[model samples]
Target: MSTLVVRRAPITRVLRSELRMVLRRPRTLIGLGLLALVPVLMGIGIAIATANGEEGGAEGLAALVIGNGMLLPIFALSIAMAMLLPLTGAMLAADALAGESAHGTLRGMLMAPVGRGRLLAVKAFGVASVTLIAVLLMALTGIISGVLLLGGDGMLTASGTSLPFLDALGRVLITALYVTLQVWALAAVALAVSAFTEHPLIVVVVSLGLVIVSGVLAAIPALDWLDPVLVTTSWDAVSEVVRDPIEWGPLVEGGLRALCYLVIGGSIAYSRMLTRDG
Candidate 1:
């Protein structure tokens, strides 16, 4: 008898292939393009309002961005996080497992020589990358459009103080990372859902429904008791970065909450993958 050897694929190569498959998808490209446009549209809207002497009506971060161009990325992220950002994450998660299953590729992947747990990890990484890219694209476009339309006026803190360019950029990066964590939590939930379904549309619908329901529940004063468990409850904490001293309390709490979701979601996904029948 002759002994034969089989080599496992390198993890880096698997991840790179997964990422390429994700980025080359037409829907992924289209979604990213649209996300990049959001900040540009916001910048244009603000510029037109300023030209028309309507800046007085602006409020919240939008008002702040008028005077602080560097704040535009933060402002756009604040708006996008509520819907578009999470939706993009949800879409990526849907495509990770459910889409592949629907196309009959998931069964093939499950039957491959790679361990199922490692396969789940690769899918999760691909989804996570999509969310990160979507956020960075929006931020980059926001920064460019803000500079062109509003000028780089540094950044204004909630305390009515000004921050230098580098300091403000650091804050913007922190804010982006914070928002990305929250969206990643959402994507994890979607990925778990994806493992349970063969229909990608079902994953998207269920994930989005969870988001809307969480938002609604968070809005109810009576549901204050549920604040600690609700996912969207701490989403607004991203604004804490805009303060002069950078409030760490809410941000830390929000990040911890997201971590909990990430753990639970990943656990469920892995369990399902292990028990799944090919």
Candidate 2:
């Protein structure tokens, strides 16, 4: 009987290694530090907007928080995706092959017992995991800052209705999830772009440019058809989630669109990574 040796490396181990590598980089640290400042600035802005006679009473504060907060999460998601998603994807994908090739470590790794497919799977998992963490952190910070600054006593709507605190909290959570899905779609695009470039900066710039172009195209009146096709177009779904009755249509449609993008992007990325001569 032939004995078979299964690859025993867990995805967590690969994720940890990737995380360590990311933390060791100065640019990664700077990006993280800048992300940490978003909530603080949001809180400060809220305070300024609500200060002394400008918006009197809890109702005014609530109005400002709810209407403004609805948009803030979306903006945070957009900014985070635009800036960090590409960097993370580059670190994961470009570094996975290019960095190893540059250091001549890929040859050694190829000689190891690990299968290329397994390596690629673990690398994708690590990239996705980091993207999720970044999204959660940004959402949590934005919510906390908004609630603290504007006071989460009662939810005020643009239509002038007040929802209970618990209801508002639920909406906030849902909005966060929506934003997360949108960001995930952006990360997938970055990963796809990363597979094309050996230079990390090139991957980052290309991914960012892709996102910007999608946004620009989606804005044009004649390009309405491209709106649903663009990955970044559904980024505004979080706002819809915050609205009354919590419209599920946009969220559902946006999620499905994102899923399509993820599938297509991941396929392209996987194909490139597997076929390349790194």
Instruction: Tell me the deviation in Å of residue 41 in model 1.
Output: 0.8
RMSD (Å) per prediction: 1.3, 4.3
Model 2 has an lDDT value of 0.64
Q: Which ten residues in a row have the lowest lDDT in candidate 1?
A: 54-63
Candidate 1 clashes between residue pairs 3 or more apart in a chain or in different chains: none
Could you tell me which residue pairs clash in candidate 2?
none
The models' CA-based lDDT, in order, is: 0.90, 0.64
lDDT of 2 by residue, 141-253 (tens): 76666666655555665456677867776776676566556656666766676666556666667767777788789879998987878877776565565466667998899
TM-score of each candidate?
A: 0.97, 0.80
TM-score of 2: 0.80
